[model samples]
Target: MSTTETNSGTAPAQSASALASKNPATGDVISVHAIQSPEEVRAAVERARSAARSWNALGFDGRKQHLLRWVSYLLDHADELSELIHAENGKPVDDAYLELVLAVEHIAWAAKHAKKVLSPKKVAPGLLMANFSAVIEQHPLGVIGVIGPWNYPVYTPMGSIAYALAAGNSVVFKPSEYTTAVGNYLADSFRLANPELREHILTTVNGYGETGAALVTSGVNKIAFTGSTPTGKRIMAAAAESLTPVLLECGGKDAAIVAADADVKAAADAIAFGAMANSGQTCVGVERVYVDKRVSDEFITEIKKIIRDLKPGDAEGASYGPMTMPSQIDIVRSHIEDALEHGGRAVVGGADSVKERYIEPVVIVDADETCSAVVEETFGPTLTIRTVDSADEAIELANASRFGLASTVFSKNHGMEIARRLRAGATSVNSVLGFAAIPALPFGGVGESGIGRIHGEWGLKEFTRPHAIANQRFAIPGMALLSFKRTKMTTSLVKQTMKLLHGRYK
Candidate 1:
């Protein structure tokens, strides 16, 4: 690993005109893309704005036809796309395929349900205004600017891309520099699937931070970003200048609770996979655990057995693959050293587990709450376990982190109760990441984890706004409350009605 050369997916600008995409495992250049300047970004947004008009004119049924065709295209090209994901993103080919499967599920959900979810519906006009019929209509925001991450390039960005498109809006996406070619392929496939449609319905802007900054202020109606918490904050602050709405999915130090009643073997297996899968680059991956003292030793022993056998490589039978970003290697290394320096001990693998690009799964026990490994978002294959006296203690420890993204509970009898007690946007009971596979559930985090929800009904609604319409049926001349010519008798009647309906409750 070279300290002087590090790329965080969203790396600094190397050339004024081009960005190269490279394979993380072999350091081989996959492809090169042209950097879109600020002027080019604006032009792209304008094109998208024009495309949005035609897109919305197609209506829900027409759009669904196109989206479903896109789904077919994705399925047809699954092998080719998965291979690209494996080489550029440094994840196992099977893991890449699973990511694609989840992404396809979201795309299908957003397409099949958009019309029903976004249709105008009658809203009740209460007794105070019974003469008017009211309805709320969903209106699509013109153009959306999406800034995506490299970890799960297809799945993560498609959360925004699929939902936004279904809601009748055009999009301009700025994919991470590390996976530029993969991003381009997604947009290109959309056009290929629907050749009769306009090209500007979806587009890509290639470059580093400057390209992203330009998109935020490119006269787009909304901006959706997925990355670190610090980057989320900066994007929010910049978007505030134009009052551009943002949907951010940021960093998470997610935790899991293992109760004494949990199935020991099942809990251990799930934890082992949850913590180390995708090289632990998942934003919602399990990084910490709190187990009851009675079951702590057993859980640790079972998990260690699983970790010792798993290996990371680009070979045919590797458990996982190399770290996608070069710079993240340093962060993972420092966290392990910090954990050991602060009196925490590794029961499985220690600092030596961290190699140049691949990191062996390390499990730390007795780590203090203040240790960097426990406190920060370590994008590596590592775990920190602490013993607790009861479920109350476990819940308290799990909720102590600044992030409230996702959590899991392993309990035979009290899993649901414990999950409800934990502070998180989503909770899985006796399982890991159950909510992610179900496209009907919305996914997002609270606090430092970022704002807004994606997937399911809420995900479709995020790209549109409501418009309320009130149509008058008939006017009672004497009881016209909104008119200046209302008589004293009507005012007296209105006062009496108000007291009868509301004032009596007190």
Candidate 2:
């Protein structure tokens, strides 16, 4: 652990307690970040709150300009940011670069669409209130606190950060301790793009769980957290103490279903990338595959061929990078071992694939539905394949999990139909993890997969509170709806009108 100070003059002095961000590839420290004290966290939130008054006053146009400038800054230094992400999170340079590209796109989407999505809109006053005109608009929620994850550090946090800012709210971001440098880099860049509003806009707080807890109760209007389900629950509880609302993008056991008429080779290739990319550390990564028994053998053979030469290492040309979190290796090993112990067979790499920082890509077949490998979120380079008699059976098994973040269905004839039946926040038909790249689509999960959404119009609204206004455009003759001077005849007439409009309610 070490400490560093904020470049902004308004930032509080660096604290003695600090945390180290390390390279999972070689177990070397990449950077050290100062852990903000609870008091410091409170101070940052107050600053953001003060800034929000003027920021919200900037309206959509002003905020959009600044956000786009931030986007420009990110693109100009994309290579440097990607390298920082690679060194800190242990993902390959190419993967890190891809994450940044997607993040930049999201920033642009949020900036371009925020005004349209959140602007005030006129609505009908309905028959009962025909004399009144109604309008609804979204108002910024002051400061937003974001707790980000290490896997896809840049992209995941930016999902909330960009949307929050675009919605006209200041943000206080807490990046994962494992990738604190990347988080700081983003905040620093944002300041450089908008130096006048540097202290009032985006700020980064770096540390482990305690620091995150401080942010949770730091009086921010809302908290957006991305991490494990258990951690999400903890954040929810902490925010409860202050009655603060939270948006959780938690864990997932996402599955891919291969229909009888599916393209086996294409499904295999897609599933391989979905499960092995980022070393399968993705919250929406394909952890389970339920294939039609008719195509199970062919599907397995295709996937085996696809990943046969794939390996996980920190070397050039490797299929993927090492596991970002060291302790995750044990979880990966246990899941593989449990699957084997419970009558599963490894069609590709097995428990022996687990190493210090890298677990070779593994594809297990016939894993029991109740086994940890198939049931729990094994955030590693592993996939469990189960054979099902029909698409209905696959849907049943896929929905059996308590988590429902995302799922994919591959079928030429029934792709869309099967996707409709799956219980997930977003489903990809004929493709894998495709919904994530579409900014207009809302992304979030139901049940233990987490709450609320990010991206698109829904994301913009998530960071805003709706305000409705009604104005009387005219007065109805002989009507005294709220007047003490209302007569018995008026009341009788109102009752008759209500019954005429809703007598069917009986």
Candidate 3:
């Protein structure tokens, strides 16, 4: 995500190894981070491997204490951290705090629920193995390498990091190069919170793409990345050499569907906020809307009215701040231009609304489904509204994209029905982004949007490996099917049982 903006402040990285963190709104240099070399990344991984022993030994309750302490520290320093996030990520301070709140809540959930979700569980032994007792135990997967995004820097990466750590694994975090300072602050805060814990329980490695590549191949137990689909493919390929597993939360061209029966005003407000919040950098941010033709007129008018007056700036009461990644400004401009060139009309702000640093909310109506602005992930404060004859047509158009991430539906009568029919990992009914705020729901995508879930009982299990134990409680005389001394009678009995259990279907 930090990669969204060039280290050279909207340009490419320089020959110097140090990374300069700048304000996207003002181009002010906040700080410079020393890029870690491949060797350094390996060393960090080794340290995590060593620290994993102690981390695992802590058990659920022991680890929970430290994680909660870290949460307390974050809360105590919320203002400070939010300010840093505002400066580097260009989000409003309140929005930054909201991101932190969600992240902290997820960490707390992972900590308190890890034991319940991951503890050993008894299982019934089959009739053929009646003498054996079966139990499934979940164990920490040693070390986790997390590649975070800058869009929702705190909330996104913490989804993986907190769950991984609470599940009993040590972590090596590579924050987006843009949010390097915030990442280091997090790792440092953990150490400060639990003074007794040694280094490597949680660590950070700073750099651009090279550092992340080094981490993928540095023999971590698994790599959890949140970024573009192409980068995810490359990481998967590189991790294949050693066969390390990966959990990728890639791009999303999320959509919102407004049915005819929906409350037009409510739908408009939620979708408008979802589309432009935090400058629309959210992976699950709404980029397109499919409305029923019967209500499309009112829905369009309402959304346009809501966002027409919205302006972008770093000043107080601003709708949203400037684009955090300078490179993204051009993409937003291009999407607006492409849409306009392809029979789309901008009802609110047009191509000129995209400034050097800030992008005002732009609403382009009647964009062709095949256009880039409609199909691709613009990652900006823009939305495309399309009118469909019916909810079925709306669903068809909404699911047309290769991405199947998060989507929203606003229909008092058919909200649940439309949500269930969506081709997304999570669908919010009646409100936009409802799934993201709930800690119990696991979040991820089916196709290019991403692979694997990360926010619930499933999230806690993502960083663990299951170990099944089968112990013999007693042995049946003359029924030693698994022993070398098994008789012909035992074999015949198994065949008869199989036939009785499975051959009657015909």
* Local distance difference test, candidate 1: 0.90
* Poorest 10 consecutive residues by lDDT, candidate 1: 1-10
Name the better of 1 and 3 by lDDT.
Answer: 1
Could you give candidate 2's per-residue lDDT for residues 1-506 as a string of tens digits?
A: 11111100111222469777778898787877778888999998999898878887888899889989988999899889988888888888888889998998999999999999999999999877889999998999989999888888889889999999999999999887778899999999998988887475889877767778888888999999898777788788878888999999888999999999999999999999999999998888899999999998899989999888887777767788987776677778998999999989998988889987788888889977788998888888899999999999999999999999999999999999988988899999888889899999999999998999999999999999999999998888777787888888878988998889999786
Summarize candidate 1's per-residue lDDT along 35-82 as a digit string, tens digits: 999999999999999999999999999999999999999999999999
lDDT of 2 at 424: 93
Give the poorly placed runs of model 2, Cα more than 4 Å off.
Answer: 1-16, 504-506
TM-score of 2: 0.95
The candidate scoring highest on lDDT is 1
Q: Candidates ranked by lDDT, best first?
A: 1, 3, 2
lDDT digits (tens) for residues 1-506 of candidate 3: 22221211243364457888888888888988888888989999999999999999999999999999999999999999999999989999999999999999999999999999999999999989999999999999999999987788789999999999999999999988778888888899899999999888999998887788888989999999998887887888898899999998888899999999999999999999999999988889899999998999999989988998788899878888988777778888888999999999999989989888898889999987788899889999999999999999999988888999999999999999899999999999999888888998999998997789899999999999999999999989989987899999999999999999899999
Task: Give the lDDT of residue 404 in candidate 3.
Answer: 96
lDDT of each: 0.90, 0.87, 0.89
Would you estimate the TM-scores of all the predictions? 0.98, 0.95, 0.97
lDDT of model 1 at position 39: 99
Query: What does the lDDT read for residue 48 in candidate 2?
Result: 88
